[model samples]
Target: MKIINVHSASLPALLLPLIFSPALFAADEQTIIVTAAPQTLSELDTPAAVSVVDGEEMRHAAPRVNLSESLGAVPGLQVQNRQNYAQDLQLSIRGFGARSTFGVRGLRLYVDGIPATMPDGQGQTSNIDINSVESIDVLRGPFSALYGNSSGGVINVNTQTGQQPGTIEASSYYGSFGSWRYGLKASGAVGDGTQAGDVDYTVSTSRFSTHGYRDRSGAQKNLANAKLGVRIDDASKLTLLFNSVDIKADDAGGLTESEWRDNPQQSPRAEQYHTRKTIKQTQAGLRYDRQLTENDDLSMMLYAGERETTQYQSIPRAPQLNPTHAGGVIELTRHYQGIDTRWTHRGELLVPVTFTTGLDYENMSEQRKGYENFVMNGSTPEYGQKGDLRRNERNLMWNLDPYLQTQWQLTDKLSLDAGVRYSSVWFDSNDRYITPENGNDSGDANYHKWLPAGSLKYAITDAWNVYLSAGRGFETPTINELSYRSDGKSGLNFDLKPSTNDTVEIGSKTRIGNGLLSVALFQTNTDNEIVTDASSGGRTSYKNAGKTRRQGAELSLDQRFAENWRAKAAWTYLDATYRTNVCDDSNCNGNRMPGIARNMGFASLGYEPESGWYAGGDIRYLSDIMANDENTAKAPSWTVVGLNTGYKFNISKVNIDVFGRVDNLFDREYVGSVIVNESNGRYYEPAPGRNYGVGLNVGWTFE
Candidate 1:
């Protein structure tokens, strides 16, 4: 194993001053309680890296449309809007999920304690209703491995709970490119809960539409979320959750270098194939919590969901002539469910310790079908119409995991946190459409692993602490990654293997004056790293690279200097590369991983009071990014600035807020994201130029 020297970078010149400056010291700020760790502890005491984004701050002076708008301040995390809704947001944490073409992979996601990621490690953020969110917690570094498979990072979203005073809110926003959003939310509490029958509830619904920044790229979405909690007794409680989302979007397809340079807004083949996607999903979950004894507690969660998707691709009719082709129109219907039960005990073991044990089980079954996208019209062929069935299959995946975690206070200023989980995953595929030219593709694969993690922390003083952590994690190929074979054969890629990684990290946290500052340095070594082998006409194949390494450093500071002024900054430097020669046509032994930036930075300043008026400005920076593993093409570095201003006032019992914002102030044209290893060399997805938006929110509280 080789270790990269993070101190060799120039970032220390900018970070060292903030760490040792005595002039910056002042009074301490309020303590922030976080639950990202198994034991509820203050952020300053947790031995891991965690950040919280307040829901109110995320919505303030923003369109509240996508997570990309508010999550840029988080270090070691990248969120990009492709400007194409057909493909969801591009999210990668510490270079973990950078290879994903569609949807999120290599990370765990949760909403209200229910799993948003499936048993197969595939997840989507479309169903998250930001209008009702109370806060979002992001956990990074080695500690993330405790969450089970694909635990490169963990994100949990908690929604608002009803309070005593019932309130109703209505909001609307309009932006450039004919984009608009409208939302409604309501929350309240019914009765006092010394006994049963006391209930609290919150519900939110929203609709969004966009004409898009590119030709033939338009989308519409509708989302609804509701949460209800009931107190059974002083020691038990039950909560119910429901979420639904519907989306319809047109796929503009990516552009080659020449096409992007000539006209970034043009969709070359979209008109001929009429590419598009439609999705509908609904999910419900129930959670129960009980206090069994004075020192023991139990919690259980059960959830079920159904999702249906239909997509039309741009593959030409010539490809459909092949007997083994799976056609250009794809359809999928999936049913999934999961359960998690855990017990926690707090007592004195050699020292004060909190121990938790849990079991998790999840299952998913999908019905997949494909059809030709063209039909014969006399002598000519009509495109974009379903022709004939060409492929059909049923895919099932399941996972069972048992885990244990313990936090021990070894001394007054020292602590230890450790955990272990044994994960088992199974996948099976059954072919339903069999022909003389196509053979049966029935296949199954199973994988198992034991993940372990430990952290040690020591407090140097009342206002500062340092910690070191290490862990092991693994990622299983999602059903989508296993759908196609690189050889163009008509069978599942049963030969694919799961990728495993070992990570080590050290970090420091300090309370300086009226602010908090954090620094972290980390490295990860991976075996059997997944890479894109071929991607064209919306079909992609995957292969495993021999080995890879990721080393990086992150720094973040949130400070409030004056009574009404605040400042924030975050920066990350990553050096990710292939360690072995993985030849697909060219050797890429030392090439930097594709779709990841070497350096990224963000800074913001804001001023506000209790009411009256408010204003803020922010700037974002990204270094050049590689487009593919061969290192043949790249996207240049770019920076953009934005400004927003808003006002808040009250009329009797009604409160109102209005704001406006402008992005890409200088209109610097840049690629928002890339399609790694695209077989057709159509890799660039251009971002929008200058854009403007205005929003209004009104609320009424009943006394």
Candidate 2:
């Protein structure tokens, strides 16, 4: 294992050019308002490190199927597609969620002011509707703590609102590996918004199917979303939101190093066990806003959702002999709901100020069951069929948080933003499938934390600003992590403790040549960092390590240089390592953290105009990444290139768009993601080779 010092002599060389270059400075760019900050502030004026991506730009010449397509240029964020839709994407921020084997953790996710993350700190991006998105706000560094638990970072997605002119559109796309997507959208306003009987609505639906790159890896998804706003009176308005998604995917499982070297597309055990997963989810929300007085207002939001999931793993029949072993088939039905009420006052005491306070409450209940994934067929074992029940349990989780935030303008050039949140979470479980061999296994646990964050900003000029921010945050173990004991027991691990950390960051935002440039340096120190203990037979256990440290620097540039030409680039350098000699099986004192890269970069150049032909190309690079805590193996460094070309035109009162794209232009073979600490050494997930796609969209507006 090797270590890279972030403060070496190379630091000055990178920081000097981006700060002192006179040619880079220019007139102010277009202002972008963001809600990720404590108060609604422009991206340039916000005290924290924040970036915004326009939805129209993201879907211009792309598939618009996954976030990995457009989020590669955001500094301090990493999104990886595993080519297997059953497991979802791998997402992390500044090494915060790198340890996760599946799904997203250590970050907060929001869709149109509704919380997409559960109370247990586990989240999934499968429900996001990219085609209807208006903009995405990514907030990083210390100020993220204002969102409460698991706030390593924050991602907020807002969908487009209806306009005065009504429009209907249809779109379709076809790609490699027998992939297809079809979508329809409609948006319009019935009358003027100021009137009592006015209404606005936006609705979208899409279906996607793919024959995946790996063997036996196939998936199909159906999704729908709708938003409607109604004017109730002169002082108040109401908005309704609805979303649903259904998915069925076959799991190919991970491949060992030797297996990947032989055939990257083969699944060794998936054929024998028929591994697969199915999911169905539906959710709705309501939001209301009212004006009470000249300087005060109120806003309230209520949301509820339900989800059901079933999965079959490749666990062998030998494990079923153990009376205490949970079976290979898992079923879960979960119901969740939440509410948020907030009040804002824009009065001044010492200076111009904006004060806001809110209370959030959430609850979830689930029924979990396990069954043997095989049955007897004339004395012979048959796989992929439910045989007998092995485990049954009911679990419940809830959280309550109260928060306060304020922004003050102390002077003309300096401002301050500060906030605090008190969070309390409770967990309870009851086991109902206990037999003589597997005695009663039930438990309860609770956790509490107080998070505080603050930031100060100073403007050097109208186009340049510098800021400093710091905060405290914490993360509690999810229900899945507490399911099995490290010692191969049959009860929840109540001894596991929550991890806590403190982060500090210094950053600068500059307007350069009709574009925006951002640079940031950050560090975080964590106590009781969670880690994998042992994993086998499709089950994983967890334990806490003593201490860890993460430090990094990020630089991003988005410039429109010449007419009809655009350029964008982002670079990240990170040093993450264990600080203590707490041993699981070996001394991992100074080892580099698993599933993290030391360096990552992205750059793209494009020639685009308001109409007619457009073209672009991009390159992405990643350094070697460790696969486990022991640092015995790693994924080699690799780079890939991509190209896209498109055309747009109008004819006979109709709009049309056609586009084509090619990925992995150089046909590079690399590992896309890693399953950390796999007991069977099946850690590598291979990336696809060169692939091609084409899309078409047609729309018409009614007058």
Candidate 3:
């Protein structure tokens, strides 16, 4: 209100240099093990607010690259890297999707369990193959509303499963403004483990290239992944997963703020009309499990996918001669499928309990097309590439859910948890080029919700514990946010609606000595929310803002000093505002809720032992953001640092690891992300000052 009462007393001097800051988690690895809580817990008894990140410590720290490079010590995640791979990474957790400008909304992604989010919750981690990653849990608050719709938290990603004997790795890396990466892997076992029936496998491939540091932002990528497992007797099991990706990029859009203070690597529309992007994706998955007695259990999952996109923006041509806009050379194609089934049970109805029931179905279809990025010249009209054939549609989406869960122990360190889900989403469209300049406006929409969740835990000693939770979440409106219409009517807005939230959290955890500490406090309340009513070029439009508030506090620590040092730290403190009162034209009521970032911190330290040489370092800190929604403009505050060193050898049998890293170090120059209401104010995105990378890995094991 009135610009926060004139900056509300300098906000404790901007939080006093983070009161001695730095934060992200690995405090002596506190018994990691996490499956984003569907069971098998240990992030110290997961009752929400979870964390785990170890994939051989992010494949040798620093830059296995992206996932904001090891999730920056994770506390209420807010990863960013708008180094624009044609707009991809920019995640948000405690500010629920942070006005997404591209991909990922209110979190919920998974890999091994399949479903890299998209039940209308939009998500993309660009094929995720952190070289066959083997961990990265991260679940947060309200039992993640039992994973129904846009859970607002939950990032699974567990890969790397093939027990023993079979390794053939090769890796390479080189970075800094003309980056490079290369990788290849193959993994073990195909029987013999006292086999009743056995099989296991893993395969990976990668290629990344970049010449970008802004300026026409170069890029090239290719990825592949595979997993397979089978052991169908002695109580069944089956698994299979596949992935493929291809990309080609060059977008470099977003500038303003005087083109980022005159040339933040310049792109300035890449010489008009050549903004680019290209993508291709393929996916597959199937999983089944059984152990139907002695405390029953069963599971099933099936997945399928396809995606193809082509983007080229830089509109203009009088917005493609109106005719209801929506064209700038975008040729999309998508096909998706899903099915999940579950059942689990454990005896003793009077005291001990565990039961879960589930059913989920998902579907998507699209063939959306649009042309006219330029090139006509006869009827006269030329600017860039693919022209004519403006807009054609055929969209469809589906969702069905059914869920139930329970967990109760009630004594010897109490426990209780519960869940419920009943989501339903549907959308349809079919325009296929209507005459007289686009009209017939096809449309359809339907959404349903009934999410619920609960939690409780207690344990006074024996390493401490405490918890309390609550949930109810839902978020819809993505089919590219109902495919356009913000006072420029033409189709699909169908009176968009689906935003609900109600969360509550309280937490604690401890295990001092070698370290492990946790703490939480949360609050959420939403009802509609959604904002950002307009954007351009790379289209965006949404509305519905009423009642919203979020509260937060988090802290994490992990330590282990004497055996070769280890340390981690985390901190968060949000207070997303706006509790009612929207008033367009910039009056944002109680402001402070735009692209999040009210204080954040992370720390790191490592020095491996039991090995020849190792080293590590980290630090992150945020604090300033708020690019729109009337907080005027901000972005500022930043801090970054990183370093790494490595050496681990073997020659006779062949195994080697050599690494090097340095990121940002002292070359700071911030603004890593922001674009919240950027209808052309361009809203920052800078990031990239100091950089360097070097890596090598070679392995061979065959048994």
lDDT of 2 by residue, 1-703 (tens): 1111111011111111111111111123112123521123257876777777888888878887899999989998888888888888898889888877777888888887777788888788888888888888887877776676776787888887787889898988899999999999999998877777689888999999998999988999999989898888877778899999999998888889999889999987778899888999999999887777766767777899999999888899987879998889999999999987777666678897766677778899989999999998997889889979998999998888777776677898887777777777788899999899998888887777777777788889988999998888887888888887888767787777888888999999999869989999999999988877666545678888789999999999999978899999999998999998655679999999888898999999999987799999999998988888899988888899999999999887688999999999999999998887888988888989999999998988888
Q: Give the lowest summed-lDDT range of ten residues in model 2.
A: 4-13
Model 1 residue runs over 4 Å out of place are 1-41, 192-195
Worst 10 residues of 3 by lDDT: 1-10
- Residue by residue across 633-673, what tens digits does model 3's lDDT show? 87888888888888888887788888898888999887888
lDDT of 3 at 417: 69
TM-score of each: 0.94, 0.94, 0.34
lDDT of 1 by residue, 241-314 (tens): 99999999999988998999899999987888999999999999998877787778777788999999999999
TM-score of 1: 0.94
Reference-based lDDT, each prediction: 0.83, 0.81, 0.76
Model 3 root mean square deviation, Cα atoms: 24.1
Quick one: ranking by lDDT, best first? 1, 2, 3
In lDDT terms, which candidate is top?
1
Residue 593 shift from truth in candidate 1, angstroms:
0.3
Instruction: Output the better candidate (1/3) by TM-score.
Output: 1
